[model samples]
Target: MAQDFDIRGATVFSGLTPDDFTALAQVGRRESYLPGETVFSGNLRAQSFFVIADGGVEVLRREPDGSQTILARMGRGAAFGEAALLDGHPRRALGIAKGSTTCWVLDARGLARLRAEQPVVATRLVANLARGMAVRLVRASTRATQVVDQRRAANSSLGAGEARRSLMDRLFGR
Candidate 1:
């Protein structure tokens, strides 16, 4: 049954060493969600971090007008809700399975258990998680800056299309 669980394709775990990967596999479990299923909702207590093994998920932000904006679309190998595992916090956005999706889910409580039983593995997991969070923060900050710049440019004499293209080029490495 454990052999069926695969983390090799996941970016978050791909960088892990043999022992680190083994430790992760011991605690992680593969879970599936159907189309339109709410994996977790904004403001709810985040229970687990997920790494997409197959399919996609969307992180959504709800505005005051009750309209939702896609904050991000997570594809295969992408990780989400990882920050919640490290720090106890409510979810910042809604994560919805875009379709029938397979994900490797790691429960925070499971990690706590592993920490008690295997301190070394716990240490590796913590370090890996920290690095992942740091990388994510950097990416998010860069994207946020681009968004602000795009809006600023659009409001100026610069046309929306040109502003958007310039922002995309700056963000996407053209």
Candidate 2:
């Protein structure tokens, strides 16, 4: 099944040679998920990294109120769960299939094997993961700043309304 999907086109596998990609692909197990099915959940032990081969997936974070906020929508060729693959930490978000999705899963054991046997490919993968993560962080920070600015503008408008109300009250004694 993995052989049917090409890993060479993925950004993380960009620098790898054809043979290296074949070896890496060999380590992956392909799985399909039905619509609305969970690919993985938050706070669970991270077992594997995933590359979307077909359909779509949503990455979501559960709020304290139990509502889930979507963090990202992934399409074909997108790679996710790299941080967990590296550190073996608990998952920070939930992954759900938006449709009938196909994914190539590479667990920690497979990553270790690839690192040992194809060090060059592993290095490129790691670099790509880091680059992807950094871009996400920057985008998040920018969004945070935008939210703060919006709130400030709203508060200023509210303050102006209050000031107008105070002046009207003073003049009319209401």
Candidate 3:
């Protein structure tokens, strides 16, 4: 179902032309989900990557203790379930509709078609995805570093003047 969606707004679709978007639409279909609906689950392999046309999707991860944590909230123009498509891996999290949401779904067949027939378009798409993923990686790395620092500070002996005393001792000959 080739519906009109401004795919240009999507980061992964950045630099794509109108004809390029049309080619993508020809390969994929548009789908809508209701609130609380499971768009994709960790148990399911990602058969497609979804670009939000409207509304949002909440990416959740199930913790070892049986609690689900929100990993991300993807708004319109954002793409989710892409890692699986790019890396040939299974989905590691669940994506649920936070509200009534619409997405442009490019399935494996579509991806293959793009790769084979429109190689330039496919290359651009992959490049954009890689750039986006790299930024996310950097952000995650920074967050991890912050968490480690916070944990170290919490674990350290910092009673009142203890930290100052330690610093002074280190600075001097003691």
Question: For candidate 1, what is the lDDT?
Answer: 0.76
Between candidates 2 and 3, the one scoring higher on lDDT is: 2
lDDT of 3 by residue, 94-163 (tens): 8889899988887677889899988887888778878888888899899977866665575465655554
Worst 10 residues of 1 by lDDT: 1-10
Candidate 1 segments whose C-alpha is farther than 4 A from its true place: 15-19, 43-45, 142-174
Task: Give the clashing residue pairs of candidate 1, or none.
Answer: none
Most TM-score-accurate candidate: 3
Q: What TM-score would candidate 1 get against the native?
A: 0.73
Error of 2 at 147 (Å): 5.2
Alpha-carbon local distance difference test for all models: 0.76, 0.79, 0.78
Give the alpha carbon lDDT tens digit for every residue of 1-174 in model 1.
155655575656555567766676777788888998887875443668888887899989888999999999988888877778878776768888998988887878878877987788788767777888898889999998887786676756665665555555666878
TM-score of each: 0.73, 0.74, 0.78
Q: Backbone clashes in each candidate structure, one number apiece? A: 0, 0, 0
Q: Write model 2 residue lDDT over 113-165, tens digit each, in one string.
A: 98998888788777887887888789988997786667666666787656445
Q: What 10-residue stretch in candidate 3 is worst by lDDT?
A: 162-171
Clashing pairs in 2: none
